[model samples]
Target chain A: MGHGGGGALSGELTRHLFTPAYGNETLGGLGDSAVLPLPGARLAFSTDSFVVRPLFFPGGSIGDLAVNGTVNDLAMSGARAAYLSCAFILEEGVGLPVVGRIADAIGAAAAAAGVVIATGDTKVVEAGHGDGVYVNTSGIGLVPDGVDIRPQRAVPGDVVIVSGPIGLHGIAIMSVREGLEFGVEVESDTAPLGSLVEAMLAVTRDVHVLRDPTRGGLGTALNEIAAASGTGVALVERHVPVPEAVAGACGFLGLDPLYVANEGRLVAFVPRTEADAVLAAMRAHPLGTGAAVIGECVAEHPGMVVSRTGLGGTRVIDLPLGEQLPRIC
Target chain B: MGHGGGGALSGELTRHLFTPAYGNETLGGLGDSAVLPLPGARLAFSTDSFVVRPLFFPGGSIGDLAVNGTVNDLAMSGARAAYLSCAFILEEGVGLPVVGRIADAIGAAAAAAGVVIATGDTKVVEAGHGDGVYVNTSGIGLVPDGVDIRPQRAVPGDVVIVSGPIGLHGIAIMSVREGLEFGVEVESDTAPLGSLVEAMLAVTRDVHVLRDPTRGGLGTALNEIAAASGTGVALVERHVPVPEAVAGACGFLGLDPLYVANEGRLVAFVPRTEADAVLAAMRAHPLGTGAAVIGECVAEHPGMVVSRTGLGGTRVIDLPLGEQLPRIC
Candidate 1:
């Protein structure tokens, strides 16, 4: 189950099974999205499977996660999602009302994201053969002209900005999973980021790296970008936002907030000169209201991440072997 | 279970759950594939989930089935498959060897079909939360110019042709499911139809309907076409090809081969004038070596299917309420 951890195990599995088998140009990115140049348009294609244990969560349900997740994936590639394909695997005993609720969520999420569900498939397995419902959503988005965003584009002088607070999504799901509710609810920050990404692109086409810290949380996402770009990431730990309720819950569960998952947050790498404008643009969006510049790419210790501790000591932030939570996405 | 039957229950579920939720122009076709018109190309998009009980089957495994299944869906739209996105939901504890074998098969099948696995995602659920592995593949194919194929395009006087002998896939799976052996082993007929469809298109662009009889077999596929097109179908029962091995296995299990699944076979509806040329083209392909004309669209009893028995009697082959075998695909 840790394969969903989005950490070492997931990387190992992909490298072991998929990389060698389907080694080709478009699939070579191994990024959040695969960018392809179609005849008349450059498009981004990506797929995500939602197996979140709880059908419903504090802020949203799997429905919102499924749609927003894929849309955000395309957004990470600087694409505006236009069409999506939804595939559902439902268990036999799941009720019609539950299905209806999920459908409504998907429809609403797509509508909110300004994307259409162009195609879809539904398959029902015998009871016990599957969980209540598992959804696989694949999307195609149009990559705007002049915008080239990828982890490989990150460089030494790049500034890292997170769209908003992290660790909320994982804590939200964990709260429901463990049936423990904090006094102040920690809801999953599940929302579409097409507009947020568009806002950033409006400011500058020089955006280098864009990634949603999903299954493996912020730590794993940063580690991946660092490893992929062969650059070091130095973080001002205090600048990374964390809500009080989320922090309290993580501390209670003995979990690192950095390794906890998030659904709607994104980490962006941009040139230092343009980072201010991009940060302002991100901050203007509703989804990016808490946007903050938290780190910068460094020349030393390439492919590693170091964060300044409150006591002035540097701590190596390693990618967890596997996420503390599974199916958080 | 039966919801994936591709029969009455399947249609009912789609009508009740999926149809209303995803009622867009392209999705409403509810064809084997959704036909999409991109900026510079008309494309066919389709998705299928493979949850066959035993991952490894006799002639082929779920790997081959996943690739060929999506490719065939695109081919049904008279399209040349170009790219596919694969998403896997694996159960924890599945051996690496199994995953490796499946990936190898997927790569081989995609290479053989002349399509590329463009992008993919993998997620693992906890042990027992899933069967060994379930694959959901979504594909996009280019619909050639002057080609328009759909079930609703079928009309009276259209000729119906089967690409090859049917029921091989279903029986192959059943043989493994029951652990029963017939003197002769039945192999799965799973194969990509991209080149085969191209061959038919080369002959004429007037192919009205092209459908792969996977679940619920030929009877259900024709019944669906009849109901969708508001036309009656009359078949020559004796002309329907049934392999000796599959027929024997079905006989032993007291199953109707007409309702058995076939992964590689397709039934085409063509105009009477061009049927001979199209048939000749299909017969020239190795995958269509066993092609035969077994039926025709008719004027009587619209939205129904009637077959002529060897005794000069007519048999109404109603679509089965659901498939006899679950997860056969």
Candidate 2:
């Protein structure tokens, strides 16, 4: 029932409604981004609309999420993000200062990500017709040669490396969220991951799958990769990194940290032989300081994810039925 | 007042706010589309978010406007549009059948425009958080060789040609709009103009400026050109083609047809000697059957627009402070 959940409902909507309408070769790839072949190069394109309730949150605002979210999608395709287009739908009664702040945030984020906002559009709706502001950003990036990253490329004997701690982004939003905040404020881990991805690719081009654990967090991202490759993912519970604050928040809220959304974390599926090099590369980066090898693709339970718990028990991390929290991104 | 009017308010917002934020070489062109250059060719990039209320009017729905609007923006740069990205913000509780109908319209419109919907995104808002649906489309197009179309290229003695009748789109939306219907029904001229642009380009490459008279209509579009080129546009009232139905509706509504929106029309600035051939080319296209030479750029009264009325008196046509009709696109 949660269409915004980025879980089964979102997947079903795509398969049943969107795919039937606009399905084509490029979209059929169904990667984080669509890889388009240009005359001399391949261009990766992706789009995302942020509808977060509280425009301003602890770590970042909707502006930061708007820019980094699309940048990460493009990066997941092993592309260096180049250009972006942003469109804003604003409610008439929202203050100009708020719009100005958001604009400043976008400009700042794009500058940091090394991508230019090349084109943009703006529209205003009557007071009650829209939230204060909702932003949509679509980006284009250049995929370097020798990079053949894709979810379907993941195979048995591949090591799974998570770039950093999970659930911070969603928990950060929830902390400042109206009627949902906990005692302590948590900052969103919303940072651009393009440079981090480039660092990983520099180590080796054998990286099979690169995913940003975003909307449905690590669990949803891994489930998608597993299904796409027709391979099973075996995650070690104790090895997955989770910040103390995020864990505490999820524990208090009776939520699984795995399903909480994140803004600036990535998961990599690399060849077993190249795991150490890629992990080293990721750890050296500032955004990837918390990198950990949490899991690996296995021959068992193809198209599923099973976690080996510290208690000597195993549990299947299935795709979430609906969104645990809506608009966390 | 009329944030969607695309007139003075829109212009000021771009000049004072957006320009300072994201303006660059490509965006500074400030045409209907921004022309981007790749290695081997020039690409036109444009974005527009359709917040047109009622979603559906007499002749077309938001889906048609979403595709055709971006396609026309690309064609304005003499580019053959190739790819498009569609993003929809739908309010929860909106029926799937309604979404299905909108999708069909989008597919039909894109097919008609000869552009592919390469990528798209959908975000759901809580029922009251958004209107039924709002669509945003950003397009990329390739400009052919020898085409250097821009508003600044409009020189004195360049004849201004209207591709078809004006005011139909706005009047049509208003006619059936709640509490505003007239005695008769009028249809929105919401059609793609890419093929028509191709036909005109086939006739001559010397055409200077191509602009689709949309939200703010003919007067505002001409004012923009005049200001961009530091020239004045002189319009002949009798020569400017306005369909009888639209004229009659505007007369009863006490609205100037000059300022009403048109969706399926374009105004061009071409050398006087090449005007007839261009007009003929426009007429040969179904979308441009009502093509007519409405005016010419003049050196006098630079950066302003004046009309030569049927009564032989000259009257200045200023850009409206706000829109006369909102969401008429």
Q: Which residue runs does candidate 1 get wrong by more than 4 Å?
A: none
Instruction: Report the poorest 10 consecutive residues by lDDT, candidate 2 chain A.
Output: A175-184
lDDT by residue for model 1 (A202-307), tens: 8988899999999888899999999999999999999999999988998899999999989899999999999989999988899999999999999998999999
Cα lDDT tens digits for candidate 2, A1-329 = 27767888878877787767765566677788878776666777788888887999888899999999999999999998887888888888788888888888888888899887878877878888888999988887789889988899999999999999999988888777745656567889999999999999889987899999888889999999999999999999899998888889999999899999989999999999999999999899999999999999999999999999999899999999788888776
DockQ of candidate 1 against the true complex = 0.67
lDDT of each: 0.89, 0.87
Model 2 pairs in collision: none
lDDT of 1 by residue, B127-168 (tens): 777888899888887788899999999999999999999999
Give TM per candidate.
Answer: 0.98, 0.97
Model 1, residue B42: what's the lDDT?
Answer: 81
- Residue B68, candidate 1: Cα error in Å is 0.4
